[model samples]
Target: MGRGIVKVWYDPEGDFLEVLFEKKEGYFRETSDDRVMEKVDMQGHVIGFSVLGTRNLAKMPLEVALS
Candidate 1:
């Protein structure tokens, strides 16, 4: 089997950054924090995550759970 590849998509216009663990079809669900979202597949596996307002948030220290 081959190793998994992570894909990152950043939109400067929207100031959004998405880090995809798997390049598959999935939808984003809001997490406990409004600035983050978790992407899951049909089976609800955390395939990736997203960060909103990156430019603004970069000024301060931030942390999030990814699992």
Candidate 2:
């Protein structure tokens, strides 16, 4: 599979997360299928993460993908 780079911005008050990534040069969705949305499972008790995207380096807050 082709790999894409992603940057995520989290907002506590907004209760939502925004992601900016380099889509496979010209594909709609570079990482997963061709959609811009996905699901995640939270695994901790924290407010935010200080890591990069949701890869091995992703420090998942509560193990959940910020929605």
Please, what are the lDDT tens digits per residue for candidate 1 over residues 1-67? 1257788899999999998887778888988778999999888889899998889785854587755
- TM-score of candidate 1 relative to the true fold: 0.82
CA lDDT, candidate 2, residue 65:
44
Tens-digit lDDT track of model 2 for 1-67: 2245556776565445544443222211122322234332243222222322324233433233433
Highest lDDT against the true fold, candidate:
1
> After superposition, which runs of candidate 1 have C-alpha atoms over 4 Å from their true positions?
none
Question: In candidate 2, which residue ranges exceed 4 Å CA deviation?
Answer: 1-3, 23-67
What value of lDDT does candidate 1 attain over all alpha carbons?
A: 0.84
lDDT of each: 0.84, 0.36
Clashes of each: 0, 7
